[model samples]
Target chain A: MHGYTANKDDILKRLRRIEGQVRGLQRLVDEDTYCIDVLTQVSATTKALQSFGLTMLEDHLYSCVADAIAEGGDGARDKVQEASQAIARMVRT
Target chain B: MHGYTANKDDILKRLRRIEGQVRGLQRLVDEDTYCIDVLTQVSATTKALQSFGLTMLEDHLYSCVADAIAEGGDGARDKVQEASQAIARMVRT
Candidate 1:
């Protein structure tokens, strides 16, 4: 099982909410809503996704990375590297 | 009409694509995909959403905000302030 497996339901719930937000954005656009209003919604949606990513990242560190570190092998270093790369990608986004 | 009026189709298309990406994330989690893989997809989705937000913001600046500025009144100042606040929100996200 993956690090997020335990929180799968929570992760899916967040994604579903984000999906709904995106759909709302489309509705606003279809109705010719003001640009600033739409942009505000976009920011809210992005924040939600960012929050979700942080939760997942924290879980990965606590579960997967911790396991690797406890095992005392090169896998610990590799996992840390992989997590850092994921973080970099997140930051760039 | 709003700043995004002309690009309504494009904006809606981007939102639809984002919605699809969010759904894909749900699928990945439900299927027990690896944590890093899911996180990677999350980053991609965030980037797409940010790109969409930037396009909408640019349109607002070129159209609504610009129109207000061209008119040269208190409204122009208000519009600029509003847009700046939106940008701040986006940056925070």
Candidate 2:
């Protein structure tokens, strides 16, 4: 099974909520809501995405990375590198 | 200025569209859309996020990484690592 298969439903639900938040954000922009207010929504949305990304990362580590490491050798190295790169990306975000 | 600041508006626009797509996916689930159909929408949403991620990565590379490299030494090394990790994460996704 895919790494995210276990939490697929939860992930979708969260993304759905984030989707609503994004729509609200668009409405804020459309109505010319306060600059700071819009920014606040943007911040929230960004955080939501970050949170979702982290959860996905956790799933990947536990499932895919764990599987790769079990296989050993190049598989292990690749998985570690993959995890490291993911961390790096997340930090930048 | 932040790396993404240059393309902030465009990025926002793209995110807004993706946000709508996410909502549509939610609707698909809520209305009991077909399983494969919902899965298809899910795939699209994932791709949208990935595309957004890549664009953000590009912006980071051009601005933040460029700045770090210009600074030289540790800064460059850190930035290179940062970029590599990001690419790894993207590939996994």
Say which candidate scores most in DockQ. 1
Question: Backbone clashes per model, in order?
Answer: 0, 1
lDDT (C-alpha) at residue A8 in model 1 = 77
Using all chains and alpha carbons, the TM-scores for the candidates as numbered come to 0.98, 0.55
TM-score of 1: 0.98
Q: Candidate 1: where are CA atoms >4 Å away?
A: none
lDDT of 2 by residue, B1-93 (tens): 556665557767977887888777667555545333444454455556666666666767787788889989999998788678657655644
Q: Give the Cα error of residue B55 in candidate 2, in Å.
A: 16
Q: Which of the CAPRI classes, incorrect, acceptable, medium or high, describes model 2? A: incorrect
DockQ of 2: 0.10
Runs in model 2 deviating more than 4 A are B1-15, B20-93
When superposed on Cα atoms, how far off is each prediction in RMSD? 0.8, 11.1
DockQ of each: 0.91, 0.10
lDDT of 2 by residue, A1-93 (tens): 656666568877897788888778667655545333444455556567666766666767887788889999898998788678667656644
